[model samples]
Target chain A: MSTALAPARTGSDERLTGFAGEPLDQRRYRRMRFIRRFEETLLQLFEEGALNGTTHACIGQEADAVAVIEHLAEGDHIFSNHRCHGHYLAHSGDALGLLAEIMGKEAGVCRGMGGSQHICAPGFKSNGVQGGIVPNAAGIALANQLSGNDAVSVVFIGDGTLGEGVVYETLNMAALWKLPLLVVCEDNRWAQSTPIAANLAGDMAARFAAFGVPVREVDSTDVEELSAIAGEEVGLVRAGAGPRVLLIHTYRLCHHSKSDDERPEREIADRWLVEPLLVHGQRLDEADRRRIDDEVETALGEVVATARALP
Target chain B: MIFAKELGDTLRGALTDDPRVVLLGEDIADPYGGAFKVTRGLSTAFPQRVRTTPISEGAIAGVSAGLALAGYRPIAEVMFGDFLTLMFDQVVNHIAKYQAMYAGQATCPVVVRAATGGHRGYGPTHSQSLEKHFLGVPHLRVVAASLFHDPREVFSDFLGRDEPVLYVEHKLLYPQHLTLPVNGRIGDLLATSEGGPLPTVRLSAVPVEDCTVSVLAYGYQAMLAAKVIERLAMEEEIFAELLVPAQIAPMDWAPVERSVAVTGRLVTVEEGADGWSWGTEAASVISRRLFGRLRRPVDVVASEATVIPSSKTKEASILVGSAQIEAAIRAAAR
Candidate 1:
């Protein structure tokens, strides 16, 4: 019985000020921080036996969702993979619905049927299986193209998704048909318990380039830089420039899922230095960062409280 | 009308009527048409709506699902029914689950048309009655093209549905003319097509109540059973009722139950492999429905479990034909 407050100020509103006169960067940071806290809360819920089934959290990868989703227009479509909470929250700002869905409440986004991975909302969708939804995303792109709509389709995949054959199949069709598809590969360098080295072979960018789709590769945790790059890529796709691939080399700061981290502690400790929150928070005023953190925690508190109260 | 042409006309009509209706397949465009020629003249008729895809069955079905999710009714053709194995994950995991998984918020009105059954020595890969594998999948309708039914109506009806449909087309039936019932009679057999949406065509040499065995079949096998029923009546003097259901999955057992109540015996024949098939499920259901009323236990006639060979004689020996249907019907009578 919870009512949504307002659409998250994540979109490029161009008002220069966001959410009570704060800068857009602060809003971006707040969104990312909210997603981070949201995922962290899910882990705590799992420990408390409040949730059943498994959830793939985008704990360290929140910036990818916040950075890329800002460029999408109203009619544009987004297809996300298993690790989708960050993308879903950034795209629809429906944390209460998502939490309710994962909690198996009837008030959930999909009426508690889709749960975490198989969520479907207006202009947004996510499936748990790797690479299976790629062709679907291409199809949506084709639909937009055929209808003469300028809306672009964006699909997010992990480094492990490259191992699926359907990804290549969709890439070939998307490139040949000149569909407006932006494939955002969030290369977190790991697929569950297995490292990318053991799973993926050959070059990631070359795999996309070989399909004749344009590729843009960047390794950064700073949301501002990623946002700028994503804006350019998304604009190119919207202009009917065929499919574009933005391969963001990022890291998974949390376990693949609940209580399943086999990664060495030292490797994880080093990644903490370049984590998106720390890198982005460095540029914001100390008082402003604290205020944003406090606001995110307060909002997430209501989302969780309302979700728990739902039938 | 020719079966394939009627289907083509139906596609043309759907494309013309709704801009959201589209066709995607391999070699389905102007020059090559399709593998079975069912999509012939479609690409030329509706240039933007019809598209030829690469040799990717998974993508063809998956993309069609995507189009359907986006409010377009897309009909994707998987060159041959055997290639549906490649599309299993997409159809079963994604397309079929989308509606229920998303709690009815999204509807995938996609039609996947594939040419199935083997008569022209298509061997293992090209010829397969794989419809049984797709049965019992939630939110998916398995409808077959039969000579007794108008395929134009079938395709049009499939386009009208809010659920996904696997439109099964027998390869051999594509070239044959559709033979509708003449005043409810096909020669000596009385013919009637019943059920709503996709239909179940009933044929009997005698009054359905007086028949000794109720024969069940679908697609090309059903058409063959109709011919076999006529011969069985004229030659052997054994009366049997044949039920040809176009919609196999989510089967409407009303007609089947009505026929079996009086007939007391049932025989199911299909072109797919013997066990774990359409025949098996029908037998299981019919037996449970009529436990003591049946005169004899239900029987099944189907292809052998071996991979279909390329040689003409070898393939003929493996697939179900009129002989198998006649023998199964004769056996059921005793």
Candidate 2:
């Protein structure tokens, strides 16, 4: 996988390009764009008195969730961490329902009992605890593997979750049983205020490789490449190839939460230059980009309207 | 029959009958049939279903919840009750909240079985009756069996009920002889002896009258309470009724309350630490509900509120023994 931090030659401009004309690509692009806009609007929603409780928004890291989740079948399970708006929205693709949940309305997916951190729908489960979902995902995979079914499970975690012991335990069990599961670590460089360098002890890939999981690292900003890798690896896992780790390198363009104001504005600005949205959309024509933007805007409008209309 | 043998048989029977039942825990299979042998010969009977897991308490909990969500009834043995401190987040946050949080879209039908109580010198960490830690958690059930209440029913009734449960077992009660009730009633005051998890088996004193003090207990404490009751009846004619509810937390207060109403006194006993115990819950609720009728402030008999010691005498001192239970019963009756 390319480790280039600078945005690469985005993609060839032809519709016949291996990554562009595919229907999956369009759906992924739409969902990623929707997640970006959805999280952006959350800032305004927070500015107004619309949402209760805090949300760890995944604005810049949308590609990691969308890329893996889009390739997964509807029956496949996705367990998530606290940075979960993008994963739930990507798997279920229901911004209105998610927004309603945030607004505490009855029409929400969980009848508003589950807020942003615990947005659980069928086939998509997320809780607020870090590293808690790893073993649960392994168990879901165990069910599929035991029943001799092809329904795989994918878990999304941050580089920070490496501190939790259950992650290693789940990794060992997943490898031992040959459970069809993939662990996607979206290494967004920071765990709240702590940098990965200070927190990490040894090599990340070496740790997973010791557990016998096939490890692959990718540049999260390259959506097309990330999508292709996710598709291949998810297929491999579903086919009983045991567990794999997709260590996607990412950088968040926004604060960890609304209250997190410790980050330098200049560093965020520098990171946005290589944002997945700008890099991935480089190949889309003015009309294509405009159309995606229009659909996202219209969807956001419906979500906000529906959420506000609810008592 | 031995109470622990009954528990093992009940697990084997569930494995034979239900395809959805899956067992997960450390040393749960083959030569090691769980730490307490509560699952002996299970792997031999059904090798595919019984799985041995690493010492991942958190994962054991999470995997059980996940398995339940995926339509498998999992019985995860946590080896010792004290280890629940590690993985209990999955229980409290995920397993307990899944049904209510998801608005019934999901249900975690998992039973976590652990050996509890302070005896046989298992030391502070190993020998603790920790039902108090898990009691009153929403959407979760706490079930413990004494010499009277059989573990078989607990496994059969709750191991696959689309709700998460903590099934507690005591280390000392495994070898003790137990009598299985053919059928019984809770109390005379209850409208019916039947429905709900609070089925009480009342052992009437010889030439029984309106009972004196009602001794409320479960697990090994119930066994001790039964002994104290029998001794009190033999010697002092105290005539205290013993009420053991099958379920501890989400407790059904009607049976205990009715007994308390008839007796006008309550003595609660348990092996857990004195503060924040199931006995404490019983004493408090009964005191508040039956304040006017209560003959005295409810007497709560429980173990010491400090770390359980490894020394045999010290362990016995910390344990709520039959002597303390009998004293409490006598005081409540007076």
Candidate 3:
């Protein structure tokens, strides 16, 4: 796993990269791009006073969702945090339900009850409580292991969630019980308004390693590499190698929620240069990228239209 | 059968009856058999399903929620009811809200069993009736074990249900015999039961007529109230009805209503510290429903609002015992 914070090489040089001997699918790019546009559209709706409550968009962290979800099997479950739109879309592909849910429509996934932070679809669940879902994910893995099913449980948490103590308690149990759990810690370097340095003490990787759970760290914004690492980690967990962690050191491109970005403007601009979409989008042909973007725009437009028209 | 043995047998029956039933707790496995021995010999009978978890109440609850979501009926033990505060977020924020928040996309058929109540001298933290804190939490059922209510029926019913339940087992009642109502009578009190899943039993004197006051309680306090009512009828010639609702949360007001309607006065008894308690809610609800019919304001007999001490005499004074219930009933009837 690469530890360098510099942007990975993109464009034609990375066009043919694959994980597990399978060529990189264009659908990955399409999914990542769709999540990006969907959340960006949510922000637009938030500004227009069309949405209720708050939303934590995974604008720059789309690669993590798209990549990690690719390795999940049908029975495998994904437990996500507040910033769960990307994970929900990548896992269940129910954008309309999610969109309608955020709009508080009756046809929403959770019948509009979950809203933005809480979403529940089959094999996919998300909650806004930081680090609270870690044990839940471990529990699913425990069930699968007990039932003799090879299903893996994957949970996505932000760097800020590490401040919660339950996460460590879960890690202790997951490692001790040999539960097939893959913990994807998306270290976006910021916990709401506070930076990682201010919120977290000691090392993130060492935290998991202390419980004897293996850690696979990635620092690049490239979806291909992230998918590769996620695949290996998920495969190992499924193969009964106990619980593992994939600490993706990335940056949140958007505000924490709605216009709460207190970071330096120069820092935001610097992160934008190496955003996941740009890195992965550069690898796709111009026409292919344009086609995917157009499809995402149309799909998102239809979702918004349908959600707004809901009674 | 003893209360703990009946609970253990009920759990064993549940484990034998369903493969989906899994037990999670600290020291609940054979040998250790939980702090109260309610789960004794379960892990030995069903080793695969009976899992002894680390002392992590939050994880025990979260894991149980996860299992329930995956189509398993999990019974998680929180060792002591006071430690339920540790699992508060998981129960209130996650387990309780999953079904409603998910809009029926999920159902958590998890039963968290915590041994509750004082009189054991475990001091401030261990000996507490914290079920009051969890009452009225949406989608969460709070059921207490009583000598009148069979543990087998309760666990079996929980296995068939989808909602989460906080099963409160009073510590003092563990060794006591389960003297169930025979021919609608337990000892000198005639038991008229109402409701289902969790029944509310109305116990009165045998020739049951013209009860002066209705004493409402649950769990061990209900037993204490039974003793008080029987003694009141036998010694003082003061007849009072004891209304014990096995299920506290989403309380079945039917029995209370019936008893209060006849007696025209009500007194709620509980072991929890005073203020914002189950008794308070019962009093308020019953008072509202039977406003004109009641003869006087409903009385709430609960523990003194203070930390429970380890000293037996101090704990006795701080806790609600038979004396308090008898005194309150005498006053309410007067």
Instruction: Give the candidate number with the greatest lDDT.
Output: 1
Q: Per-residue CA lDDT of candidate 2, range A1-311, in tens?
A: 22112111133111111134445545556667888888989888988978888888887898887777767764688989888988887776677778888878898888889888777787888888888889888889989877887887999999999999988988998898899999999998888988888899898888899998999988658788887898888888977799999999898777887878577788888889888888787777778778777867875787788789987
Winner on DockQ between 1 and 2 is 1
- In terms of lDDT, which candidate is stronger, 1 or 3? 1
**Runs in model 3 lying further than 4 Å from the true structure:** A1-25, B206-208
Alpha-carbon shift of residue B87 in model 1 (angstroms): 0.7
- Clashing residue pairs found in predicted model 3: none
Task: Give me the displacement of residue A95 in model 3, in angstroms.
Answer: 1.7
Docking class of 3: medium
lDDT (CA) for every model shown? 0.87, 0.80, 0.86
Write model 3 residue lDDT over A1-311, tens digit each, in one string.
22112121122112211113322545677778778888989999999999999999999999998888877766889999999999988776677788899999999988889999999977899998988899989888889988998888999998999988888888988888999999999999999999888998898899999999999999988999998888889889888899999999999999999999889899999999999989988888888778767777776787788889999
Docking class of 1: medium
Given candidate 3, what's the lDDT at residue A151? 87
Interface alpha-carbon RMSD, every candidate: 0.7, 1.0, 0.9
In order of appearance, the predictions have TM-scores of: 0.97, 0.93, 0.95
For model 1, fnat equals 0.76
Model 3: residue B170 alpha-carbon error in angstroms: 0.7
How far residue A307's Cα lies from its native spot in candidate 3, in Å, is 2.6
Return whichever of 1 and 2 wins on lDDT.
1
Ranking by lDDT: 1, 3, 2
Query: Each model's fnat?
Result: 0.76, 0.68, 0.67
lDDT of 3 by residue, B87-106 (tens): 99999999998989998888
Of 2 and 3, the candidate ahead on DockQ is: 3
